[model samples]
Target: MLYVPFAILVAALLFGVPIAFSLTLAGAFGLWITLGDVGQVVEVVGTTVFSSVADYTLSTVPLFILMAFLASQSGVARELFAALSSWTSNIRGGLAVATVGATGMFGALSGASTAAAAVMSQVAVPNMRSHGYADEVAAGAVAVGATTAILIPPSIALVIYGLMTETSLGDLLIAGILPGVLLAVLLAATILIWVRINPTLAPETYPSSWSERVASLRGVWPSATLILLMLSLLYSGIATPTEVGAIGAVSAMALGFALRRLTWQGVMIAVHQTLRASAMIFLIFIAAKIFGYYLSLSQIPQMLVTWVGHLAVNRWFIIVGIIAGYFVLSMFMDELPLMVITLPLTFPIIVSLGFDPVWFGVLTMMMIAMGLVFPPVGMVAFVVSASGGVALSKVYKGTLFLILSIFAATALLMVFPEIALYLPALVRGREF
Candidate 1:
């Protein structure tokens, strides 16, 4: 019964068990079966839990998470959206375009996709609706736009991927830059086209005066400064991911206070939220590590790698199959669970095929982006629908259309790996 552990894991998931518990239970069971010793399983569990989150680098996770929560509670989204919309207000369906821009900008601060979705739904959807935009358009823009948070720098997803694969965390974060911007551009373009095809979708456009546009820029300095600081530190190699995260969190809080948006109560809330989110992520990390030990004992990843190597088909064909599997699995699972569960199995196969880990990390993130907005169980779609007061069906329809832009962005990355690699390459003076 080499597959019994997986069967148990699937059953646990199907029964609505928490992912951390499901992984821990399934992994402990697998270790017991393979080692045939109860004492050994307990020992393994003890060691894995401690070692999993003990890395100095993993410290970045909580810090970035804090920065995100602080930014969320500090009224950053409102001013950020206003500033972006002022510039884009002349175009047809420009508010939706501005929503995407605002989301991406906010992404540099907040790496969590659901947080981005929730914040933008509150900030952008009401404004779009007041301007005569359709529910689908508004909902779709927020859902799709939030996906960029997972790709931008300080992304918790990228951080976890780097930890799992032993890739450089700096490179992984930097690698997401161009690709994230590309997705944002493509998403904005898609909204523009959608409005052009159906002018009724957004009947009126608000064109801002030059003075208003000029004044709007004043409101965005905090967000712009924070992002520039993150990029400069990262690009110049002046700080590690952990240091960057620490600086970002402190900067976000300081700016919040300076702008008179953050209060003592707000700081308490941000800290409380940060602790909860970090604990959850670290719990999963520990569980996934234990589960990975079980997989090693079972030799599943090794066996899969050998089997795939013997296939005579073109390598791209194999990549296609893996990507299709990711798309299907991600439709029902959240991105972190999907990454933690599948990376152990798929990463080995990807490495055996001579694929670049950093490139694959970005590709996996693109798939995660699609899953965030795809139908059936798109988490971001649910967040947007719930927060924006839009119908779930309308949000799903909007995401379905917006998902095409993700496909286009993915296709572009596949054609030119440098899009994700260029910035990362410059980080270390190494060529990819």
Candidate 2:
């Protein structure tokens, strides 16, 4: 009976049905079959709707979505890129490294990967080209940098993970901090290495005036201040996730208006974007709750955990296998649906191993980030290619070495779980 719904889900996904509808229908069928009662399905629907609304933590989802959309209207990406480039232009491969930093900075506000990739591709690639950067190096850096957008705070993907796995929203948000910073630094190092290997890949930078660098910083402080404000409030337990999200949203809108970057039309566009994104996430949430209920009733999570526990291999091998599975699945599917499908199964096995759920959340997010930019299904690579007017081949070729940065960060997190957990622990300890 469990296999029936699972099969239907795969088929629906293959046939191009939206994930929410597929999950809902498949879950409804599974429930109807299991108890020989359709009434239970009705009951599940009613309860799911009520429970979803009543869950205050989940309210953070749309508020953050609104904040991201509103933040995008502020036109911060170009300012961020300019500031980073001006500050770093004196070093070899500095512009390339700056692109990585800028993407992370903008992503801290917008929380949208494709938007980040596109904006940076358009803004940074031409500047790199004129600066004599190899097309491969320039395009690859922007594309790879864009992939990290979701790993930063205020990330939609992290929020989705929190919702699905029932992890504390604040813990998940704070946990991503160190790993995100680590990945950014690794990206900078990767750029330096590539430039050193072939000096022709990037041109030398002229010295930047200190005045120009200081002036450029003006573009970033508003967005940066909002991020710090939210994190501080959440970390200190002065506000709940919902309250922080609302605060972030209002701050972003105010910032946009103050900068004159957001006009009436921009406001409308942000609202429109918020509605679409929020609706999609909401639909998926409802479907997942029902689908999760089916999985619980079927005992699949426990059964799979018990089976994996009996394997003769070392537990870490199973863990490696699980991460590897995410890598492969991520190549073929978008992160959200892929997570919705696999987390229920793998999440249990992770808990069974006595691993911290917050650490696993960060691990899963990193894998998903790699999947977003890795060949041949790297979604951000495609966006960068299209926006930069470069061939997909060149984009991937340039991005190849940087992919190792993500892998290295993941390995470090595995060896030192504190990379993902320290902030969460301190914050939770202080708050709780």
Candidate 3:
């Protein structure tokens, strides 16, 4: 019976209905089929959507979005890349290495992969190409490395996951630190190795003097300060995610004003973009509530978890299956709405298996990050191609090895849960 509604949801999605409307219509049908009253469906959806979207914690979404947009318009991306490049441009493939580093650093502040990809594409790709790097490697590095945004602190993906699962947002955000850094290093190593093997990939190098390296630090302090502040607030339990985001937003605006980068027009543009992104996320939040309500009524979620608990298979296989399932679903769908609709089903099953929610949150964040580079519907890849004016085929081709790197990082996480748990546990002083 639950399959009926799930099918309708998929069909609605396939037929080009918006995700919010698709979830709403499908959940309404599910409620009608199960409860036999249209009014009851309306009641559940109206009440749940209202209550859930009104959450104070969820307010972090727009604040972070605003912070990122303002930071973007304020020249943070360009400055950070220039700073990193000045320090690294001399060695073979050094500019590409700087691209990975800059993308990772910028992604931390923005916490949105698409924005990071587009910005890096504009900032890094052209520079790499002029330095004689191949299109696939340049575009691919931006596409894959931008995924770090989805795992770093203040990530929109982690925010949605935390809100839906009733997990501690602070713990989830902090848990992402080690895994994010590990992926960045893996990506930087990949560039070094690939460029070494196929030296043609990067022909020109611009090495800098030690004095220039010291001067380059001038461009990095805004990002450095914001990262430190956000992490300190969250890790020390001094501010909730929303407060941290508020402070970040205010600081970004102040920096823009100080640096003379925020024109009145830029502020307007940033606010407008923030509203657009926030509206999309909030709509999905409301629809997820409606869908989640229907799932709860069906008893199917509980049954699914119970069935998984009773399975004779190995527990680790279940974990792999969930991660792999996300990878497959990502190829056909947008990540946020897909995650919203599915967490109700997967969360319980994962909890019943006795995994730490915070650790699972990190794994889930990694899987979501992987989706940004997955083929077919890889949004980050598309953004890179468009922004860099490169062929889509070349971008996808480039993402292949980077995606392998993502998988390798995922394997590390699975083999060592402590990698994600250690920082959060140490911060909170709890044994995992």
Candidate 4:
């Protein structure tokens, strides 16, 4: 059954089928072959599809996606970049540094790497170009900065990981905060270092007047308020992560309306985008559930776990092996699809080794973060380059520094797990 499904999925993907369709077709084929009855396959497919998407926890996806779309459409992205640039414009490379900082904040609200890249590229790239900053430097900053979305709180990847792993969403969300912030700081520092060494790459801009700087804060307050509301609700246990997402959507729409920026067309577009994205995600999720069920029935997870446990190698070596596998897989796959396919295989192994699943989720997300800026297939890089009308090579060059920064941060987290664990522990009163 497993072999059949894998073959079908691969064949369909190779033929350029959409991922969701390929997954569903593959699962249907697997069920048909295993049951030896077409009727039974139909029944299993129908039942699994219904049960998989009937999850209440999944409601957060569309709501958060909608909120992000609305915020991006309402001119909030430009406001955020402007505010950060005003504060960080004076020093050499400060504009690039501020782009990373702004991207981090934008990532918190949006949680979509492409959206972050598009937003920042539109706002920051032009300004950097006008300032005589190198095209590659500006494009690269936007590309790498956009990837911050993957590790930040409200991340769609984290939410999906929590749902799939059956880990606490709040715990995973909280776990992301520290690592995400640390990565941002490190990336900013990297930009500063590079600018100091090669000042020609990034020209200095005059700092805005204090009054201008202070006034720019008004445009950014909506995003800040939204973040505060989200964090407070989740931290205080006042709402589940799903509820927080729904509240965020409603709040964002309200803000757009109050700002007189929420046109009927914008609302329609947001709803349409949300629906399309939600449908695609749910379909993949349902298909993955059937695939996972088939794998369990075959005892693949247990067999792999038993095999790993039987090995006499050091546990840290095994952990490193698993992380390395994820890093490689991420280069070829989008984070969501990769997680959906591989988490079942890896989760049992990690748990069998006495590792915390929540911590591992954070680590896994960081690995995905690195993949988002990697060359050729990096989705964020593609988005940034296309948005800025810059070459992919330029984007890759700029991301080199940010990638090193992410690796440094990844090493810190790996050496001291507490960076990812501490906040969740303080909030939840137990290690997850």
- All models, RMSD in angstroms: 0.8, 1.9, 1.1, 1.5
Q: Sorted on TM-score, highest at the top, how do the candidates line up? A: 1, 3, 4, 2
Candidate 2 has its poorest 10 consecutive residues by lDDT at 423-432
* CA lDDT, every model vs. true structure: 0.92, 0.85, 0.88, 0.85
Name the candidate, 1 or 3, with the larger lDDT value: 1
The candidate 1 region of ten consecutive residues with least summed lDDT is 423-432
Runs with alpha carbons beyond 4 Å of true place in candidate 3: none
Q: What digit string (tens of lDDT, one per residue) describes model 2 on residues 44-133?
A: 877997786567787787888788778777787788889889988998899999999988887777776777888789889998999988
Poorest 10 consecutive residues by lDDT, candidate 4: 26-35
User: How well does each candidate superpose onto the true structure, as a TM-score?
Assistant: 0.99, 0.95, 0.98, 0.96
Clashing pairs in 3: 90-207
lDDT of 3 by residue, 25-127 (tens): 9888999888988898778877877797888998999999999999999898888988999988888888888888899889888988888998999999998
Please give the clash total of every predicted structure, in order.
0, 0, 1, 0
Model 3's alpha-carbon lDDT is: 0.88
Error of 1 at 428 (Å): 1.7
In candidate 1, what are the lDDT values of residues 218-316, reduced to their tens digit?
Answer: 889989999999999999999998999999999999999988999989999999999999999999999999999999999999999999999999889
The lDDT, on a scale of 0 to 1, for candidate 4 is: 0.85
Question: Higher TM-score: candidate 1 or 4?
Answer: 1
The digit string of per-residue lDDT tens for model 4 on 329-350 reads 7876788888988898899899
- Candidate 2: list runs displaced more than 4 Å: 430-432
